[model samples]
Each structure stands twice: as C-alpha cells, then as structure tokens.
Target: MTKTVRIALQGLTCDGCVSSLTTAFMTNPAVESVTVTREPSQATVTYNSAETTPEALCSLVDDAGFEGTVSES
Candidate 1:
C-alpha cells in the first residue's frame, strides 16, 4: 500500500531548495511523488509504505541539510 505524508520543513530559501528537496525525496525508489513548496516550507510525499516509512522520508530531508518533521495532520 502507498502512503502520503506531509513533512513540515525548515531552511528552505528559494526555488533551488524546493528542487533540492524534491530530488532528495525522489532518490528513494519507493517514492511515487513529491510536491515541495517554499511558501509553506513543506513537502507532500507519496510512497510505497511497504518499502519506506515516514521516518525514513524525514531522514532524507535531514540528510539534504534541512529539518523535517511529520505533520500531525
């Protein structure tokens, strides 16, 4: 099954940050889609839950040099 998660992000400054975060999410083969917005400083990611977890996704953002936390909603 696939799962979608909203990750609140920090340290996003420009379009480049968006692109970078998007790329970081896509690097995971289980990721189906990623939408990042600088205005909201968040990313919506869809992925195969069987293959990846929300914690793992957040780690990717952290590895990319940003802070990422799963939204409660």
Candidate 2:
C-alpha cells in the first residue's frame, strides 16, 4: 500500500535546502515523491508503506541535517 505523510521541517532558509530535502527522500527506494514548501516548512511525501513508514521518512530528513517531525495534520 501507499501512504502520504506530511512533516514539518525546521531551519530551511534557502533553495539549496530544498535540494537536500529532495535528495534525502529520493535516496529511499520506497519514496515515490517529495514536495516541500519553504514558507510553511512542510513536506508532503508519498511512499510505499510496505517499504517505508512515516517515522522513517522523518528520520531521513534529520539524517540530512534538518530538524523534522511527523505530524497528524
């Protein structure tokens, strides 16, 4: 199954920030797409549930040097 998760990213202040965020998600084999907004500091990630979970996705962002957290909203 596929799932879409929205996460909040803190400390993004430039376009290059988006580049790293994009790279973080794309590195995961199960991630289908990643869309992040700077003003709102949010990312909508579509991924395969069987291969990856929302928590895992958030970890990716943190690993890439960003402060991130998954939210119900």
Candidate 3:
C-alpha cells in the first residue's frame, strides 16, 4: 500500500535545501515522490507503506540537518 505524508520542516532557507532533501528522500526506493515548499516549510512525501513509515520519513529529513515532524492534517 502507498501512503502520503505531510511533514512540517524547520531550517530550510533556499532551493538548495529543497533539492538536497528531495534527493535524500529519493534515495529510498520506497519513496514515490517528494514535494517541498520553502514558504510553508513543509514536505509532502508519497511512499510505499509496506517499505517505510512516517517516522522513517521524518528521520530522513532530520538526517539531512533539518527538523521534521509528521503533520496531523
């Protein structure tokens, strides 16, 4: 099954941050797509639930030197 999550992010300053995070998320084969916004400081990620979890996705963002929390809505 595929699941999509919206992650609230902090410490993003530029397009480079977006590109870097997008690349990081894509490194996981389970990730289907990633869309990041600078103004809102959030990322929408679609991935295979069987292969990954929302927590794991947040970890990816954190590992990229940013703070990420799974948005409830």
Candidate 4:
C-alpha cells in the first residue's frame, strides 16, 4: 500500500539542503513523490509501504546529515 510520511526536518540551512534531500529521496524506487519546505523544515514523502518503512525514510534524512522525525499527516 502507498503511504505518506510527514517528516520534521532540522538543520536545513539552504535550498541546497532541500535539493540534496529531494534527490536522495527520489533515488528510492519505492518513493512516489516528495515535497520539502524550508521555512517549515518539513517534508512529505509518498511511498509504497510494502517496500519501505517510515523509520527507513527518517534514517535516510539522518544519513544525509539532517535530523528528522516521522509523523502522521
């Protein structure tokens, strides 16, 4: 099933950060879409739940050098 993951991001300094993250998330085959906002420091990722988990998405953000938490939309 497809699920949307609302992520609260921290330490997003610039547009570069957003772009970088967008690219990183897009690389995941299971991810259907991603929307990131800098002012609010949050991201919405739509993906196939059967292929990926919320924790994995959060870890992806963390591994990219940003802090993130997953929440329900």
User: Which lDDT tens digits does candidate 1 get at residues 26-48?
Assistant: 99999999999987889999999
TM-score of 1: 0.97
Scanning candidate 1 in windows of ten residues, the lowest lDDT window is 38-47
Superposed model 2: Cα runs more than 4 Å off: none
Estimate every model's Cα lDDT from 0 to 1: 0.95, 0.90, 0.95, 0.92
Model 3 lDDT per residue over 5-44, tens place: 9999999999999999989999999999999999899999
Better of 1 and 4 by lDDT: 1
Q: Is candidate 2 or candidate 3 better by lDDT?
A: 3
Angstrom error at residue 28, model 4? 1.1
Candidate 1: where is the Cα deviation over 4 Å? none
- Residue-by-residue lDDT tens digits, candidate 4, 1-73: 9989899999899999999999988988999999998988999999999999989999999999999998667
Scored against the true structure, residue 6 in model 3 reaches a CA lDDT of 96
Backbone clash count for every predicted candidate, in the order shown:
0, 0, 0, 0
Residue pairs with clashing backbones, model 2 = none
Identify the candidate with maximal TM-score.
Answer: 1
TM-score of each candidate structure, all chains considered together: 0.97, 0.94, 0.97, 0.94
Residue 7, model 2: Cα distance from true site in angstroms: 0.5
Model 3 worst lDDT window (10 residues): 34-43
lDDT of 4 at 33: 99
Better of 1 and 2 by lDDT: 1
